[model samples]
Target: MTEPVRRRGRPPRAQQDAGPGMRERILDVAREEFAERGYDKASVRGIAKAAGVDPALVHHYFGTKEQVFAASIEMVLAPALEAPAALVDGPLDGAGERMTRFFFGVWDAPATRAPLLAIVRSALNNEVAAGVFRGLVASQLLARIAQRLDLPEGEAELRASLAAAQLVGTAMLRYVIKVEPLASADLEWVIARIAPVVQVHLTGP
Candidate 1:
């Protein structure tokens, strides 16, 4: 029998043990790794070790540390990225309230908030993490919502950015900084106060 030749970069499958859940496990561990170490210190080897997989598998799945960090950011932001759906499914009349309520609802949920806190902390301090975070938020989340709005070419983006600023600033105080009154206030209470402003940003002149 002739000998089989292996590809240059690919590790042997036996060594990879890349079962169905392996990729997700690596990502979950990577999130915690980046959260703990920040972007500069987190490494493929460290992430692989944490996930009990080979470093090659991490590279194979995510390409590099930056890519891994980007994936982690997307995972945390997945909930928020669905904002356009709320805009599309309902009348534009209450779109601002829907958007506001949806944004906080994701933050208020315990399941999404934990990983979100980790990614947000990393983005706050690391330039690389922050860059990736900003790029994804603009392209994936805000751009989609902007497209859903009826506006002139450049104006939709501006409106969406304004609304995003409003929501993001409020979230920073309420969730990240835990400012006393705002952070402790009821979710609906915050929504009632903020949604009107967001509506003005989105649909007002």
Candidate 2:
């Protein structure tokens, strides 16, 4: 009998390890790789190696390095993205408090904090990562906030930038730097102090 013919292309490596959660696994690995190496250095091949899959598989799942990085950012920020919606239904006066609570709620959750922290830390030290982080935050988070508020294009971006600066600064102090009382303070206490500042940034003249 003639020997069975082998497949023309490389055998399916991802299928060998593939299962219900393979995509998620790849995303998780990609996030870590991007965080550790920054956007410029992180590669599909490396991510695939770390994820125990083939480079082609990474390409198959996520078109390019930029796409993978974008997916990773979305995954990390999914919970926090809900913050702007708090502005939609409530009185404008309480919008800041709602937004603040929503922002901290995600950070306080242990499940999401690790990847979020990784991105923040990496962004701080790596210019390439910082550019990616800034683009994602501006496009995804800040733009949503500006849209919800219905401000003029220029003013809306200004307001969004100010709000982001306030929250990001607070996060750096409370979570990253672990400043004296802010870090150790109750969440409500921190919220109380921060809400007004954010409120001013969002709504003040």
Considering summed lDDT, which 10 consecutive residues are worst modelled in model 2?
A: 5-14
TM-score of candidate 2 to 2 decimals: 0.82
Candidate 1 deviation (Cα RMSD): 2.7
Candidate 1 off by > 4 Å: 1-9
In order, the Cα lDDT scores of the candidates are: 0.85, 0.81
On residues 25-74, what C-alpha lDDT tens digit does candidate 1 reach at each position? 88899989987887778899999898887787788888979899998887
Model 1 scores worst on lDDT over the 10 consecutive residues at: 8-17
Clashes of 2: 0
Runs of candidate 2 with Cα error greater than 4 angstroms are 1-20, 35-42
Q: List, residue by residue over 1-205, the lDDT tens digit for candidate 2.
A: 9966635334275364577688899999999997678676889989999998877777777787877877798888876775576554677778788888888888888888778888888778767667778888887788877776767889978987898798889988988889988898999998998889988888888
> What are the per-model C-alpha RMSD values against the true structure?
2.7, 3.5
- Error at 175, model 1, angstroms: 1.2
